[model samples]
Target: MSVTRRVQNTVRALLGLTLAAVPGTAAAAAAPEADDSPTSASAGLRDPARKEIAMRLVSSAENSSLEWRKQYRYIEDIGDGRGYTAGIIGFCSGTGDMLELVEHYSSAKPGNVLEKYLPALRKVNGSDSHRGLGSAFVRDWEKAADDRDFREAQDHERDRVYFDPAVRRAQQDGLGALGQFVYYDAMVMHGAGGPDGFDAIRRAALEKAASPARGGDQGTYLNAFLDVRRKTMKREAAHEDTSRIDTAQRDFVRAGNFDLRTPLTWKVYGDGYRVD
Candidate 1:
């Protein structure tokens, strides 16, 4: 088998072994029925339809397209403080996340293209500088996306670093799919868990209005969250465009899409889309 395929198989086998080693954790419970009611007890984004809508919404904002899967090879500085924002969820080379991703990828497949960049990646961590990384770093990152193992690592890291925590917080807040998606998108744009990150924005929003967990109206709570997120974005030059909030997510709120039900249409960066 090819090296990439062997890595993929090994990762799968490890995952299977890990799951098997855990008692009573082999199977997940059946998902709850979908409910659009703001105060419904079954509110969550676990359903496949809701998950797809959430993914599309984020893609529209981040990539200006609904094809988020195609963004694995995306890499650029974009003048953001974080250097080398790349991959599916914009892991930054400067912030140590890109190094972690490369490490994970290399663990699965030694001698991979990114493996040689470990020293540079580690040196560049925690700062916004490409001093150690040259043009070849960008080329290698894009090339690595062609490998299935690399793509899987990116997906896993995106979930572990951003998606899962955001969704979990939203569920704890008694939020539906829309609210969960709001948190997920914010975490993607902002640092996932930091002093000035999504949690900070969420806390500020909570001060203004109660979350659904505290019996607040879902629409009102989400509006508060978006309001905070917009302010946060405007504070940073790289994220000044508030269309993702004002147009895309707020449009759903206006349409009463708390459940994120599809046949949905929205716009980001003045580009329109329909996800039916």
Candidate 2:
């Protein structure tokens, strides 16, 4: 295999994620200059926030559906074990594409820089200038395939090299776009996501998944998450018990492809998407 492919394979093995699944930041426009780091402040400080509410509302909805009180971590485990990994927008991987967007304005650029990819490395998720990058990058995933242990060798390989300083800009913009994208993606399922043009995107995704464009097991996990969430809503409402819905949801999930629920996020949701 080629070197980049080899690196990708290594990344998959070490991080237990599939690049076919984790391409990051789907179809974003080109990035501007990076934000201000202590090392490169003033030059890269052009930064901003996104339009994503953390999963607190979703969790609240889930909680009300069940009428039971459980910790977010436990509920996520309940969700993940059942073949879906839900999380807030920060570390959602979809938003991680903002790593390419170093500055705030789309047109901003810095003085002549030295290297081709050096700009990408200037700002990362947890940097001083990174507003929501930390949550987008760091998460209490509950486990690796259910083990939440960050001490494993795979975790080290993942946090160190997988999310390496590949770009120099702040990823907030990319992250913001990603969060909105997913929100829009989910909104389509609920019958509304942002303005109006997004409806076409929903149709294209459905059509593509039904055609030859079906990727490495396309739409299974996300579909499964939607399935469980829907059922969880109904079940809890009928029985008036939150934990009961959580249990039923997990049962349904375990029956599906367990890997669909893998939380490392190797696939880029927009990978190979040809829809306009």
Candidate 3:
């Protein structure tokens, strides 16, 4: 395990936190005791309406479309070296999540179209190599997208691998809907364990500001996190466009929209988007 991984494990163990991953991101140790306060701030991303908003917000950046459901069949390599970025959350073929999604799909419905590609998916698990899977695999993936089971599998894997952990950690940190969505977006874009992954970024942000659970200002802490995320995104060519933070999430933070109220407007890659 990396130094960041070790520290994260110790932190989670101490806090009794079950988060994003066995290979997931890390969270700050300070968890606010559950607050049932009937306030917008207490409403989290798990709330159905809020969750839908979160989905649209992320889709604006990830798929360049607010119609996130349309992206279940989306697949292609955007040259990030992560290989086929697909589905609603941009699950990369090079990354483990895509493989895991296929595995989950295969398990849930055996002999699924995607099940046959498990070996190829496993082979390219960590690095970008399309040795065994080429156009045929891509076509099959699009075909599989038409299956309701495949769609559910994508949703399930997304929640298990990214959404659930992110929302849980953000809620624990006393962040409202916006913060929870911010964490979820970061977790989706950056995986859990690497140096530039979500866990490391979270750890870096915590170094600069205490989470709201620790009594720090919510906006201040979120700014710290976004600043760190922006820097991390800038360091990579594929993620060089930081508008997801500068124009979207940062705008929300600057406007004091911690509850992430609707009629929201933002841009990603200079394209305008709105959720009202």
Candidate 4:
């Protein structure tokens, strides 16, 4: 079967297991732990500690800063064929997601600065064109970043588009915060749920190792996933630096940190970072 078909089958199987009444099934075995640490009281990486670590990782890759909050106003056309890579999660204007974020922001705060560019945003969706956008759009996006509502809208859209689905898939696969963060990071860099995206990387990893949901070792499976992610990164010039996987996530897996606990230390792009 095709990779996309396999991913769909995997998700369907997982969802079925989650709804199944069978004893000792994958769903029953993959339940998330209760909140004992500073993290949230649910499954996946939604907890505060895990979320903070994730933000730092993304920031290290995108902005070289641990203060991910500072990237709210970050906007630029990096000539990557994806127009206007901006915001905390690097929402691309060409992907229609950025337009969706602006829509949400406008809904929350009417007559926002970006509201004027709705026509241009629609035109530029799925293409590398800044035809109707220029310095003013950049300035307004930066200005919008100053608003709490705008920031919240960005956060909501990031979660809705990337973070939540990645975490859900990891949970279904019986993976922990590390694995969930792996999925999230992949989704952030390469859009989620597509054939050449996160699901393909995951399916490739599954071919090499069994998932925790399939009664495999979590760390081993994650290492396999990172290996595939590294290969995928090397295929593109912009993502050629595989240190984020080799030095960062791989370090966590080497240390047997499947749960992605705190006091974490790693390097991305040759810069040292620590999170406690």
Candidate 5:
């Protein structure tokens, strides 16, 4: 067997999530079509309007509001152990993404307000220690957020580190607009490594159902993917809220709205939101 197959089998066994009812496997299936139709491929999250809807959907969960642009200055430690979850995509201080965001920002605009905090951000990397960052750092971050350049940097980094990759992977898997958005949301939250990360969740879902790329039913695969995501969130105290899955994505799947047509309504954290 190939190295990829070996890894998938190992993860499937470790996750113990084999779904016997789902048909086919990566080895047994033909490669998925590049586009289900002309409209589907171009109309996925790559479209500007659809991407805006995705932003609102993610913001509903991340900031508890659909006003994603307002979150450029948002910052706080939610006690998630990642430390200082901030910005539109919730880059964490404990995780390396926040540090990278600052690095990117500094590279773009020299002597920016947040440049001084780089040393502190690096020192606090991998743990929730605020040894070098405190209220002053928060102040500087908020100040930096006001800059148009800084906000643009956050958007660039967000697309670079999360959104673009997720959308590409989803399209490659022959997913539609909704599936593309689903992948983007998962990438925003879980990222792409470790046991509870986006990659692992996808692997577990694959063990239960083949993706559309692998000649599987799109709805079945998406439901399986959401099941893995929900279970993963429940495993963590900070990410235990499954309403994003229970009410939003699953609602879309159940409705067979694979194209993710707008005029949609959903609730997150018990707050209703609409994108028309």
Candidate 6:
């Protein structure tokens, strides 16, 4: 099967296992412990944390996979009076928007494929780049690998963290890549970089998906970077005055330098994504 097709299979398995993955928080309600009680930070939108993470995601590109550069060829142009918003958000926007979209995306259907794979899909975005794709985010997974168990472990974590618990929380709570980015880190926390450690995350994500917290709503969170960009476009539209647009965009140049905080016309959003 194709890699995307394989990813779809993993998504299917996540849906199948939803009831098994959710952890019992009832114990916490009965008698709370330090880790069991959970942090207010775990379930809310923390803006300071979001911004800092955004910067990290953006800066990480220099150290990211080369594959991403090829797949999302346009992402590098962010900033400087052109392109979508730069940094991690730029990458988030690029990845989430670029791929072959999963079906039934709008919270509309029961077997909504978009709702299905979206958790893991959006959750995949914290990468410095997607050049490594699965391996970049998943430690032992190789698109070229022939081992079934190695592939399965990687698939499991992909489903676990991205498809179920983490992605869902991010969508509902409005956190972006901050939590999604942690899954890879979580996998590393297991036994080690070998198959065993990687598979631990896989199993963990699956366990979460199977849990009761999701309540069978089947709703999936879209990485909102694109939505934010849309709003940014609207805001930019209100500010457009043609004369000002031209003046602001062309405010003199250092010859070959880039402006970084470049202003874009509302039209740019439509065109950029089409080209993006």
Off-target runs (Cα >4 Å) in candidate 6 are 1-48, 54-58, 61-96, 99-180, 184-201, 204-276
User: How would you encode candidate 5's per-residue C-alpha lDDT over 134-225 as one tens digit per residue?
Assistant: 89888989999989999999999899999999989898889998899999899888888888888898899989999999999999999999
User: Whose TM-score is higher: candidate 3's or candidate 6's?
Assistant: 3
Residue range 148-173, candidate 4, lDDT tens digits: 99999989998899889999999999
Worst 10 residues of 1 by lDDT: 1-10
lDDT of 2 by residue, 41-132 (tens): 22221111111111211222332111111222221212111211122211211222223221211223342121222243243322323233
Candidate 4 similarity to native, TM-score: 0.84
Per residue, candidate 6 scores C-alpha lDDT tens digits across 235-263 of: 44322222211221122111111111111
In model 5, which runs have C-alpha deviations exceeding 4 angstroms? 1-41
lDDT of 6: 0.26
Pairwise TM-score winner, candidates 1 and 4: 4
TM-score of each: 0.82, 0.19, 0.84, 0.84, 0.85, 0.20
Q: Candidate 5 vs candidate 6: which has greater TM-score? A: 5
Give the alpha carbon lDDT tens digit for every residue of 1-276 in model 1.
000011111111012321111212211112334555654425467665567667756765666556667778877776556778787677888777788889999999999999998998888888778976778988988899999999999988877887889999999998888888889888887765675589899999999999989999988999999998888878866677787787678877876677776556565555556654
**Residue 238 Cα positional deviation in candidate 1, in Å, after optimal superposition:** 1.3
User: How many pairs of residues in model 5 come into backbone collision?
Assistant: 0
lDDT, each prediction: 0.72, 0.25, 0.76, 0.74, 0.76, 0.26
Off by over 4 Å in 2: 1-52, 64-72, 75-276
Q: Point out the worst 10-residue segment of candidate 2 by lDDT.
A: 1-10
Report lDDT (Cα) of residue 2, candidate 3: 8
Question: lDDT by residue for model 3 over 10-101, one digit each (tens)?
Answer: 21111123211121212111222334445444567877777887887677666555667877887776666787777878787787889989
Which candidate, 1 or 4, has the higher lDDT?
Answer: 4
- Poorest 10 consecutive residues by lDDT, candidate 6: 267-276
lDDT measured at residue 256 in model 4 versus the true structure, 0 to 100:
70
